[model samples]
Target: MPLLFLRRCGWLGLLACLLTACGSHQKAPPAFTASGYVADRGAMRLWRKDDVAQQTVNIVSVYSPYKGENTVITRYQFIRDDVRQINRTQNGEHPETLQIRFDDKGNPSFMQRQRDGLREKLSDDELALYQFEARRLLDVSQSLRAGQVILMQGRWRNGVMTTCDGNEVDPDFDRRSASWVAARTQRSTGQLGVAWLEAPEGTQLLLVANEDFCHWQPKKSEL
Candidate 1:
């Protein structure tokens, strides 16, 4: 009976050692999600939901050519409930997915705009103010874990059109922009020829998008 007891004790000891070894091999999570934004090479720009306008934000700027006397009006408006991409560098690197619940408020910190091949960060003074407001609105007193990585990525079907100031291209129809687009248009031809709705000439176009595409509308001020 003593020998049997000793054998049982030996088995228990072995099991404990195995468990300890396994625990030692396990990996702790890479970083806390509350750490804010995850830097990625592929995505140069990162935007947080908090930066989105709670009501509406508008800015009008002027664009001038280096030599020509021509000038263009640039208007940017941000508004509420507008969901835009928060991660993207456009640096030609593979995009890493952090399986995250995007709806969760206040983590990424601020909206970042990258330009000059990701060499420069464009500043949005208003967005900074909005970031402050977002923090004030969110209760981030509790800590949170980083998002999980999605092993299998999602796929999408889309229409593409590319053009320059003097050039034009056409694309197929997509309903995202309007109820008519996805339904009426089968195929498209000119980039400048995109579906158009007439309104007063002076208008502010609000855009929300990632690298995929832009959804724009004339601000209520213009309407």
Candidate 2:
């Protein structure tokens, strides 16, 4: 009986050690990530930062229309999968800004909108729509991440490209695409900004313009 008890104790100790080893090998999720998708008439870029300790998430999305000059940027703040606040800004001929905050019970605590230099009130339907969109975008971000789609932005100068974070990268551009980017860069008076999407399948160029996109990009600390 004594020997059997000792063996049982030994087995329990081994099981605990094995569990501890597995826990030690487990990897923590990344704190920051980015993803994007092609919208109906344009493209949208998303950046997300997670506060694991606080159980919160912050996401920023930029939508640029293909034919229109308008650019829409939205920020969503979430507390454990529940949206806490949303801020949106549209820039173009008719600029607008909208802000909404929700209480602990998910009720709207504050809502405001300003368009064309005039302050306006948001209707209940509009508020609901914004909340729905926020949830939809969160789902979209999760899908993109699961599919391993990544968004990258950089500056192109004299045939060399430096990423927004200042890392040099050689994008997988074919001959025709490379030539076109080079031509555009040469024709532009200022440094050319480039944004692209990368996945296991291939790389797709999203935008190339004279304006610097890094200027307004959110950093990890800001998120």
Candidate 3:
């Protein structure tokens, strides 16, 4: 039968040259995820790991609920997981401490922080959600190829409190400032935080997020 059709076309030409030499021996890099607001070198300052021991840092800065004068700073850190390591660098400028470890299926398996050159201030949609989470961690480098998710939607500003002059007051839990002028005549919705970083770029992820709001009592401001 024509020598079995030439041995089935020589086994389909050796399976297309071994699938083109395994797609040129694979290649791709650059990635990140652990959801926004991160700074590490073993914890130089700024972190957000969702949970493990809880964390929140951004030490100081006051005002700007809506640019009453443009001032915002209040930093702090300590994350639960999302692997980070860079530990030790106290005063070249900022970030002076950090240490973390977590993985074994909990994700962010190891971390360390510190890199004294503090420079944190991101907004413009948090730098387009950190360049779409470093391009979705370079398109899911691996975890078998996919497995890392983080999504956040806005319109929340509950109870406000972080003063020592760093602004954002509502001490009574919120409700004053001339009755918050009927909460600016009601229905405002403005204050956002969005994230979607995937993680991959020498793994050392972090994301310690925090939010609080619940003090809106306005129903009487008819011009």
Q: By lDDT, who's the top model here? A: 2
Tens-digit lDDT track for model 2 on 149-177?
67899999877889998999999976766
Candidate ranking under TM-score, highest first, comes to: 2, 1, 3
Write candidate 3's Cα lDDT for 109-211 as tens digits: 4443434544444345643443343233222222212222221212224433332224453322123332443353244454322111222221221211122
Q: When superposed on Cα atoms, how far off is each prediction in RMSD?
A: 24.0, 14.0, 23.0
- Model 1 lDDT, full chain set: 0.26
- List candidate 2 stretches off by more than 4 Å: 1-29, 174-176
lDDT of 1 by residue, 1-223 (tens): 1111112323334233334333333344331111111111111111112223255323322222223333323233334532221222222232221111123353333344444434333345644454443332121111111121111111112443332122333322233444434332344322222321111111111111221222321223441
Task: Name the candidate, 2 or 3, with the larger TM-score value.
Answer: 2
- Looking at model 3, how many pairs of residues clash? 48
Error of 1 at 44 (Å): 24
Alpha carbon lDDT of each predicted model: 0.26, 0.77, 0.26
TM-scores for every predicted model:
0.18, 0.82, 0.17
Worst 10 residues of 3 by lDDT: 214-223
Residue ranges of candidate 3 with Cα displaced over 4 Å: 1-30, 34-84, 88-96, 99-145, 157-223
